[model samples]
Target chain A: MASNWEEFYSSHPQPANLSKNEDLLRDFTARHLNGDTRVVLVTSGGTTVPLEHNTVRFVDNFSAGTRGSASTEYFLDHGYAVVFMHRVKSLQPFSRHFTGQKFLNMLDLIETKDGTSVTVTSENIPKIADVLRKYKSALANGKLLELSFTTVYEYLWLLRSACQILAPLKEKCILYLAAAVSDFYIPPNEMSVHKIASTKPQTISLQLVPKILAPLVSLWVPNAFVVSFKLETNKDLLIDKAREALNKYKHKLVIANMLQNYRQKVTLVTQQSSYVIELTTEQSRIGEEIEMYIVKNIVDKHEEFIADRSGRS
Target chain B: MASNWEEFYSSHPQPANLSKNEDLLRDFTARHLNGDTRVVLVTSGGTTVPLEHNTVRFVDNFSAGTRGSASTEYFLDHGYAVVFMHRVKSLQPFSRHFTGQKFLNMLDLIETKDGTSVTVTSENIPKIADVLRKYKSALANGKLLELSFTTVYEYLWLLRSACQILAPLKEKCILYLAAAVSDFYIPPNEMSVHKIASTKPQTISLQLVPKILAPLVSLWVPNAFVVSFKLETNKDLLIDKAREALNKYKHKLVIANMLQNYRQKVTLVTQQSSYVIELTTEQSRIGEEIEMYIVKNIVDKHEEFIADRSGRS
Candidate 1:
């Protein structure tokens, strides 16, 4: 049975450092509310469900924070302040483009008797410069705030804290929830204190994770533009699920993606209409991101949303 | 019931790029066999068990590949050719030092009208230089071979391929199985092709993953020295579990650790002798690592094992 969101929060303890993060969130949200700029809270990456209290084993949703991280960059370019809440080690904006050995490989060492100097190889200087300039600019202007979480418990706690802190922004705030949060989790009460033994067959019972969107849309930030994502392996269930979520939650949009081609294509589903955003084979080959178009469409729609509400008032 | 290792191999299709990885492994092993250096195949990081064939969700072990990555660097220092098999995005030997924003933060952009030059800041130069020099030297000497896997299926297949390739090394080979391998897994036939519905409570049944160490010890690379790791959240269970594994697999050693303080302390368990390798509080506070001590002990023991066998022959 699905648990009550209120009861869920009450039953589960608040994650460590929730208040501390909330302080940062409040400060960031307050700073943006004073400005004419729009604010976006982009929740990225996947949430983990620990099978054991100390977490020797866990169930994880598959996400590298690609959509959310890329979308944050686009949002920043569109003149919005972004709070990037992501999994601890998942990809982040600016740095996501160059990962693994690619980062180190771009560098060269120049050693002299005086000292050693590390320089970006000439061939890779342009790309590094572009990314670095943007990264430095964002930090310099205080346009980006980063927060991280690992487990589902921590994610939910942080999300609610962010909502309360962002509540003052109301219509000016946007919640872009691209995180692949676990829909089922082993609650703390049932989790083993130690690592589960390997000697026997294991049967793991997972309870339904209470739908936080119910409370979030109605109680937390009703006037804010909220966007959710639905990922599937089977394409047939994609649109129906996306539309269902939109109708049920009365949210602004649902981005539907198939697991196989998520980076290349996604569907933007709204209450009024549904549209497809895809990268052509050549565009994909030449390194075009579907998120570029996705973010553009959403930004345009968000303007319409803000205007419509102001007209109603 | 536990499935036989041979049947398990036959049941699951080979991982993609297995043949390609095997070819690389063959070449690396052949090159090392021609040389006088001992080769250690160090498996690091955690393995995943996909809940769906399309892999929207997976069961994962808790490991950042710290022990394995750190050990690989130490093995290189010990004059051993190293095969570093790890989880795709987990920590690596050299690059592990700088992760997340730390890498970007260490860099400075020097832009003139002529062009832009990216340089490591003065404070970070010494550390980056040290790691880079070692990294370059290892690659230049062809003493390091890296292979990566994301899932348990891929790890197992690659491991067996590596064993077959390294068998010719005989007593000169060391299998340092440090990866936090999953003990239970849902069979491929039982996994969902689509994302599992989250509308209700879910019960996942996992069977015991076949013990590959049995075949690894008896059938493949029988003459090679092998070491396995056992981690428990409870310290009381640590030594017993390690000894049990040693007795069962008849492998050369088992490194036992408590998950809570693994980096600070580890116990080396062998048939006739068991000892603890620990970092003092002062050492840990000073950023000293226990892997340095662990690797030194293992390298010394490895030499003794090789000499003992040669003397008997």
Candidate 2:
């Protein structure tokens, strides 16, 4: 069946049905082109494990894709072509379709189940409804939503494919590995099962599946400017671990975050220096911090490093 | 001027213009309460920091109050009166309102947004939309959303006020600190004006402010069930750091998360045992795991601990 499935897809040669918001990539690349288009891949949300045919176990996270989507938006605002590989239900609109009257319609249904009722309305209701309508209008117009992905394997597969697409654009491409890919997956054989019955095995144990995505930095994505992330909770040892990951992965930069508080805590670790990022509070107005900061720091460094290596800026 | 402002609000209490949604809080409380309503305080969303008179900086979080609201739902589902202290833009609903047409309306919206626009004559959309509508609807209700504060100082101030409200209910009350707070804040006197003229700071220097909310666990919320979160990024040193924080703050449990991969990686570090959480790619189905695994783990433990300590079931 697997062989047949592969052959069918191979023979069909279908366009990958990718969806997600990658305005950051487009914007980032447009502003600072390294003689090529910069490609960014952002993975998000969590995957599920099938416990049974009817009942499945969800491998999930607390991330609503705020960080990933926010970062993705920043990238787009700056001119980079982004390939956002994400799981389902991320708060981010996979395409502009995630907004509009439909969303508010959900709200309306919640208030008054029957469409004819039209019971719930107030000073704020219209305002809220307007916001929803605007969102839906945006989605209808395809202005907000972009990019897509559904599963862990699917995310990985498309991400690898995106890397391949960006390979030819290497001199100008940048790979920002920000998605939190799952560290494990169900053994392929159990994909169709309904549930892992206790009677089957009192202690069902499995082996760790080596992460195939991380190695991509050193292996396939070597030509592109790569930035990896290392999150540590220890305020004392976060930088050290970040440096270690940078050294091991040989990526240009490592974003280190102290797990103490996540409102806005990201530290950029490079070969020579570590810059702590104090993200603007929720109260602050939106500006180009993530994009501006990275461009000022990483992209410029990439240019300088390349110039020093190849004797051109 | 500050004192005058305080006096104004004190003499003329800010009229609670309770919206229809706010009214739902009462319904939820009544429907959910099991025994004597001892004490309940629920914190939601990101806080806002007042800058100028009308233009205040919002130093909030990326949290949409999904977790907070879900927990609230669980409490209400189990019959508990709750005092919800939330931030702006919370996405949870106060109650579950589902009807025939209302359910179809939700489906139409989902389909319209997805662009499939395929009509589902079946009750699938209503059933699903009814289930998914809680987060946003609950938030629309008149929950206590604390505004003001750019730095952690202001957040701490608002938190203190909330604590004061919950003080009388402290004996059997539970204080759920689910809001994502900024650990750092700008000094009130050090507030600066935004300048688009210069792209750089003339003399960029700032001093660290003391954490205002930390004292609440030991001081104001002494007997309250305090559950604090410690977000970290390192895998190797997670428990050690979490344990250290637990010792310092002496809270009940520290919900620790790795910095960048927080959405996917979580760890529950108690005084004795530690449980590491890894999210799989299961799409929206993962909410169940969040409740069953992480939420249940803590609640069950807390219940057991409380029962053992108080010698009650």
Candidate 3:
């Protein structure tokens, strides 16, 4: 049998930067608590399972961190403090809008007598300015805290530390787990110390990674309204799997999505009901992202959850 | 025993875009051939082995495509027309220097009563201009042609198509195989049609990928000076493994490096001798990339090879 999450953590060494990141999170959370702010931890991107300690190769999930990054901005717009934990070099909130060759395409290099200068092209200035204004304001107000991780080990360590810090806030916090974490991994004790050589036929055996949600929901931040994502390629199985996860973890909700149409549609699965949200063809053509709708719905639910808890107390 | 390269290609389906890319390559090659230009096909990044047809997850080699992208620029500087074949979204020649959050950091957004505008900061303008100028010139002069692939299947199909297009050029063509291709893969026939469900423990079986260099050197573009890279984490076996590859493939050179030190140093292995080339710490600190030296050495060897061929004829 595979080790459970607790055993996995005890056996594996904590990431070297975990303590430093925890300290940063502590300060950020403390500041928010004093102001009676609502906080959301948005975990994004894909976690990699390294095959070796020296790691020349890894098992990776397909994710651009589009969902998490996009949702973080919307959360901030709704006046929620966000802990943006994401894969390093994956899309980031403001930077996501300008990544790849898009940034270069948006700029015009002008040459004058003195020298050359690069500026956003006239047609692109409005959109860039809008994103930049929101980004700068978030930073200035310290409402957004950014942290990054690469390997699965680092992500697990940082997640636990973040949860530990958020525990005191209880019902005031929401755990929006959007990251596509690895399902299997070669444990630290089994991974190669060096790169696996290509000189011979190789068999790599990876064990199922213990489900972190087990500890996360049950112990780490028990009172936090936790929402997890369940992505499947089969439409028929999507809602069923999501509902199963919600039942097992006893979390607030599970966002179900089919891999093919995730960008345009998703289903919100709760214990009592499941609702589908989709973007119309016209809306997609006009560049309205599905994340906007998803975030809005989530915010409403989170608010209702807070109200219910406060009434009971 | 594993199947040879020829058998593997015969059994596999051709990448959907292979024929389209071949048309582009054919046209590009004809133009260069008429101009008497030396052409280098630089393969960059890492090919992925998808677990399913929908590809929610993959086994990926750890590479940012730095070696291939940086070297392409140097090759271009030395007046070689380049066919830059790379993994989708991996680094590319001029654009690489500005990727990630670097582009955002190098700019400033200014607001006025009229509107807001973004411009490259004065300190960063010159460097950005130089890179942009070179990138524009390359595209304008038809000196660079790019083709991108994601899966190992696409890489194999495109690679063979590219070689067929370059075959008529013979010795004037150089194959700089820098992409970190997978040594093992789950064939199309075996891959799941949808995403693999994480409902239970699953064991994936992968077969060794046939060595492409064998057919590449002996059949496709036989007269091209082919150089391959051998990346290993073990230092003691690096040179020996590189030499072994050279002997087996009958290729011109193998550039060997330890994964940890690859950015700073590489060992050039040829049939007669091997030589180590390394960058000084000061050079590295000053932002000098080792690709410049590697490309220079390869260019020198290529010239010698051309001369020797002419003498023999």
Candidate 4:
């Protein structure tokens, strides 16, 4: 046991891979020191799964990071310090000019079927589910975004940890929860040691894991501004889902979208009213509109809070 | 007669929004006069039909132009002269460091559909078909790539002229025939002034114009190194289509891909063998592989021909 512990201690494991985004973050932070640099946290690309070998497993998503990364630059030009948390293997390298954490682990999990109502202790369930469902076509096409995770437990762990890490920083950040996460994962009892051949009889159950980060918005980080996304196929359900998400996370804003045509079509659902931004008519301008809308809204909300605090003082 | 010609020219004047990309190209051309510099042309994004006052008639591909634009930077780094001809809304801004042509008029094809056949008369047919087929899923989901031409003759005339303009520069060009061109266009007799609606009549007869570029490839530009792409639904049919394309265009290489999971997977079909590049494995690394393969092959081919000429001398 002592030798085992010694071996663990003696073998110098490589330090964590440093992010290339540090320089970019430093420069951005430096620029915002004196200004009301609208700080926007944009997460781009698909999460990566590390395999047994140093290589990767499977990946999903085809974001190209165009919408997110390009919007970051646009936001910066419009005087915003963007904290871009990116997934690995995106087409454009995240400007190594910013400050952000890149969580490079595939979160895997195993859950009972939804009907069974099995209890799960995992975190960030909805976020992971959101990531998976929202980017369904992008994931299916296998274009720019790719992802791989063996189990749901690992995925939940990664998801919760990432949100938690960023949760504390939420005080100054506008959380753009755009990353899609998976809702279903393999159940612990049903998981196979090796690849399960079709010959094997296996019954898999999926249960909704309690959300790990949504509650945190109201419970732990009440001062932080939150914005979540709702992707639905039914138009009627979109606004309701967005409201549910907003109320649940207590977010200031929610972008709800029905599975519309691929041109970045979404409806902005705020506490006051709802607005739809159609990409069908203006496909090329979708990214610009989304980025501008999010940035302006966040900045405006932040300013109002600041003014309110000043007034009280 | 002179007044009529002037009136015609004034009525159909070219749009003057081509300066930014043109200037970049001029500056890029001027930068590398040392002869040690190599050039790479990157054409990206998609173009659309300008229609509405607030909105425009748009036709676009799934082509974010990521592959082409990203690889251009790589080529420029290795020292090469690039004349990039691009459509509207490309992924990257025409690199300020390269020679570029931002032509809004790529290939204007007037297409009408028969029971199972599509007739196109313009050179842009192939590109249009390619984009539509590439974004098949998105189309099914609702966002469609639509094109409307005033006349089939107009489309044919534009295509012919565009090819003629670029023919002389074929010697210095490495044509990356990534754009999907249509196989057929409508004939004059079949033309009609009806907007294609979602609910259509039971029957329609359409006459197809034979592919114009195929004949031009063999007759006009015999020395150019042309590469074409072949997309198929069946694995067995891929090589057959590839061979047909090669024979038709007399191209040196063809990238054959199947519509089955093709958005995520593709094969590099050359004269010798077919290589499948699994996009699921490495994200950014896959982009690297594509760049290396294209660049190395071009460089080697150029060097080999030069060596052969020297040996003959």
Interface RMSD of each: 0.8, 17.9, 1.9, 27.3
Candidate 3 vs candidate 4: the TM-score winner is 3
Per-residue CA lDDT of candidate 2, range B1-313, in tens? 2243243224322323333334443454443334454435666555433221222122223455555666666654443455655543353434213311232233322224633222323445454444445444444542223232232343455566556545544445567676666432333444453211112222212232334435677667676777666544345666777798778777777777654565566788777777887667783354443533555565566567657658752
Worst 10 residues of 4 chain A by lDDT: A97-106
Task: Give the alpha carbon lDDT tens digit for every residue of A106-156 in model 3.
Answer: 778788897678888999988887887788789889899999999888999
Give the lowest summed-lDDT range of ten residues in model 3 chain A.
A197-206
Q: Pick the candidate with the highest TM-score.
A: 1
Q: Per-residue lDDT tens digits of candidate 1, residues B119-218?
A: 9999999999998888888988999999999999899999999999899999999999999999988998888888999888999999888999999998
RMSD of each: 1.3, 16.7, 1.9, 21.9
Evaluate all candidate structures by whole-model CA lDDT and list the values in order.
0.91, 0.49, 0.89, 0.42
- All DockQ scores: 0.85, 0.02, 0.62, 0.01
Chain A superposition TM-score, candidate 4: 0.58
On the 0 to 100 scale, the lDDT of residue A63 in model 1 is 97
Residue A191 shift from truth in candidate 4, angstroms = 22
Question: Worst ten-residue run, lDDT, model 2 chain A?
Answer: A196-205
RMSD of 2: 16.7
Stretches of candidate 4 exceeding 4 Å from the true structure:
A1-41, A44-83, A86-161, A164-174, A178-224, A228-250, A254-313, B1-81, B86-162, B168-174, B178-224, B229-241, B255-313
User: Number of backbone collisions per candidate, in order?
Assistant: 0, 91, 0, 64
What's the chain B TM-score of candidate 3?
0.96
* Model 1 alpha-carbon miss at residue A150, Å: 0.8
How close is chain B to the truth by TM-score, in each candidate? Answer: 0.98, 0.65, 0.96, 0.54
